[model samples]
Target chain A: MTTAEVSAPTTEKPKRDKPMGTETRVAWTFIAPGAALLLLFIVAPFVLAIWFSLTNQRLISPLPTRFVGFENYLGELADPLFWKSLWNNFRFAAFVVPAQTAFALLLAVFVNQRIAGRVIFRTIYFTPITVVMAAAATIWVLLFNVNGLVNGFFELITFGNFAPDWLNDPTWAMWAIIVVSIWQGVGFQMVILLAALQDVPGELYEAASIDGAGAWKQFTNITVPGIRNALIFVFTVTTILAMRLFDQPTLMPRSPGGPLDSTRTTMVHMVDLGFGRQAIGRGSAIAVIFFVIVLILTLIQRRFLKEESAQ
Target chain B: MTADSDVRVSAKKSVGANPLWRWVLYSVMIVLAAFFLFPLVYMVASSLIPDDQVLAKSQSFEAFVPTPFVGLENFSDAIERANLPRVFANSVIISGLIVSLGLVVNSLFGYALARLRFPGRKLLVGVVVALIIIPFEALAVPLLFMGAQVGWLDTYQIQILPFIASPLFIFLFYTFFLSIPRSLEEAAMIDGASPVEIFTRVVAPLAKPAYATVAILGFLFSWGQFLWPSIVTRGVDVRPLPVGIGVFATTPPVSWGDIMAYTVLMTLPLLVIFLIFQRQFVQGVASSGVKG
Candidate 1:
């Protein structure tokens, strides 16, 4: 698929300007269905979200809706639980972005080697990515049980000194979710980085070694720079994913964002308010805020990374 | 050393030529592999055991081994209790529609963007690129409100329609269509073939990899959909497997074995497909990741 296709000769050259009318009509006809759907689904919802945030809209309400400019936003800003959920989102991203990226890069480098059974190893590591997050969370909820295999292994290794109730414990709930997120997501980054690693010319490594460079030196100088763009890409994508932490926390915990609201991410909070509490206005407010944060982070990362790459 | 010797040294280093280092590398890979495989292996094993014995055996190495196997008892129980058949059919219909229709719609738009000289072509492409940055979660709340307002709640189309015109997939298709040579289309055009004929007979045949990549990824995305379906479908009539499994796992009188069985059942088809199309799966992910 990557190889360039050979161009074939034509029997006759069609006048491009003459077919402009027909070509434009055909193009619009082709694009119409998808463009209309995008307009109805994505664009319309986005606009409604902003409008809903401004007004006091309820999912099912008796009173007529009225404009309540900035009230929902102000309420959310004043709510400690809202701040907690936002903090939890940031905290999850902080741990996952670095940990998953590093681990994935490590796995990618290892599997990139010319080792026997590397394909099998790659497949094994990547199996989690295929499993649905709900299934992964369900399986992991059992594993993270007090007397489950995870604690059992930890007890065996630590001589029974430590075994926390992962999901129920407020302190450990987010951490458990983080572990699952990293486990399920690292394989994706690994595959991407592995592809990037393969693209790094072997000649550079050979040249570096000729200058008496060690493996670590060659890795730091040649390998890292070679895959710099991929590293940034992985970092940014992982952060965005971490910010959307919902399925695991919702499914794993006793309740969605249980244990003192410790695992209440922004998305979870939005859902709880919007659907569960039937506070559509507040939920839309949170959604707008969440969207802005994601947009700003993505834009900042793009600019920052582009500058770094330039340097 | 000579240039040839340097190449040999690097080649040897790439594979860990030293015996002890290679042994260490193998050991690490094996341990990591085991770590990655343990939860899945345990899930399968627990699914086969009886409910009472599932958690009991999880405390030790025996958890990895399915003893006192009850065969398909848990599977039968889970299917009956969770209404797995209905949910499974629902998931199949939903994902199938999304994948098939999505391919046609998104690929057509992509092809138009790549090949057609429409008036608003550049503007449409820019809009798609801009739309790619909007996370779906950010829109879920408002979409739910919109869905409720339009009386679209508790329907299969609500789950399937919004996702059919994905910006990311559209962009992926756009870039892929751009990459292929257009000479064949031109040749076909010279033969008095219309644009649609040229697209179907000449261009579509050559874009199999792009289609396969989009189809596999699209199916996986739709099949695993949780958030949208959760809010939209309040009943089991149209709920997909991911949401079904989530609800099943959380329902009262939770049985570990039954839940594992259900999970295994929910995951089995995708696992089989992934194993069969491992190359395409990896390629799909890598290409999407690198291109994005």
Candidate 2:
């Protein structure tokens, strides 16, 4: 059956009242600006990048460009640094995604309660979300200083015997980046999860409590199950963010890469290739490959993390 | 339900629970809250200090407090050195242009899909969904090359055009329009209004909140951009505040106090907008389902 017959004489009829020619023309006219901009920005750039990835487009040159199909990919494949940087991205994602999720969920749960100063608490947690990464990076450098608040916390608990230069120490730098990433990142995810958590029925918790369930049990069995979609959404977004791994690492250190190239992410590497070293073709190749990896990672995450089981 | 109502239930339940437990929860929450607030506190504190005492050992209990108060020299100096006013002007212009143009393109596309029927409508919706996942990082390189090819480098259009429409923004409008009743538009049409007139006068007026959400979102995006502008802008001439700050922070003779002042200056307007429209901001983020 046609759409008109199947869905006859409702609000849908008004839209179909016009002749096909007029409707189509109106649709095109309405869509023209967005379509044109999308084409110019998204589609054309995507096609251009694919073509550039196949060729040798030096950032600067008297040298003419040539199509070196698969050469760039092969070179990237053989480069150990490429692998290391990609692994760095993976390491970042692995650490950040779960940590961010757990902390965000905790914050959301806490603020979701009947508590004094809940608005104040909510705003405090969310305040960091307002911070620009550049400002965040600058602020964090002091926090990691030997005599900074990190060590201040240490002194309050211990003797402050071991204060390390966080951004400069290769051993501590990645951890430092992870710390900063979580702090700035968690607030946003918390807000999302909070919005989801609010949608869940409070009566379920009350009923579970009446059945002699503890808070932990209720959280695990009820709250977790209730906000399962939001959990996936938060987790997926966090993972994708980790894969990108740009601004936090870029800004956290005395320089862009952190100490001893320990925090040099795939994004930094891409920037180094495209802008720093002026090898546009190699960078384009990296970007495409990076996109594929993210796509694959997202698929794997969805397969494993989907809420189908919850249903 | 709000926390007030939730808390009432918990308070009743806690009548039989331990009294100390509630105190402990509040303490932990307060400490963690302070931890999250530290950087913002530190930025403002540092900015209020004299340049000499900014990074120096002070007589205060904490590292953030300075011994002497500086009378906004840092703010003045930072503005002069970074030419922050000019960069702020650039940011305002860029964000303004992006929001104004973005609303036009995205809203039109949304109105078409939500209200009009044509061939390829489903396919176009699919395209938007697919495009939404294409992160700007992945597209950065090719876009840069395209910018160079088209001689758009160091131009305002380079910053403005690439961000004029996004699938998420279109979806936001599309969803909003779908929620709007169709009979209103039909009545408008029967009153001899054109379809375009129905959209602008009839539909768009009712969609003011949607426009505000998109506008605030669009403004935040264009203003807060760092990496893209870093790539595309050639130098001080076209660089917005964040990019200019990124570059400035890297260069030598970087004064901590001045940097903090710049941070405060750059951050306050956004913070104010956020505070004033926190509800709309939350709606924007939730509806778009993207990170800030």
Top model number, DockQ: 1
lDDT per residue for candidate 1 within B63-166, as digits (tens), equals 98989989999999999988999999999999999999999999999999888775657677878989988899878988998888789999988988999998
- Please report, as a residue range, the 10-residue window in candidate 2 chain A with the lowest summed lDDT: A1-10
Count the clashes in each prediction. 0, 1
Candidate that scores best on TM-score: 1
DockQ of each model against the real complex? 0.53, 0.47
* lDDT string, candidate 1, A1-311, tens digits: 11111111111114456687788899999999999999998999899999999999999999999999999999999999999999998999988899999999999989887778989999999989888989889889999999899899999999999899999999999998988888888999999999998877777877787798988898899989998888888998899888888898788899998888999999899999999999999999998998998898789778867787689
Task: Write down the RMSD of candidate 2 (Cα, Å).
Answer: 3.6
Error of 2 at A238 (Å): 0.6
What is the lDDT, from 0 to 100, of the residue B246 in candidate 2? Answer: 60
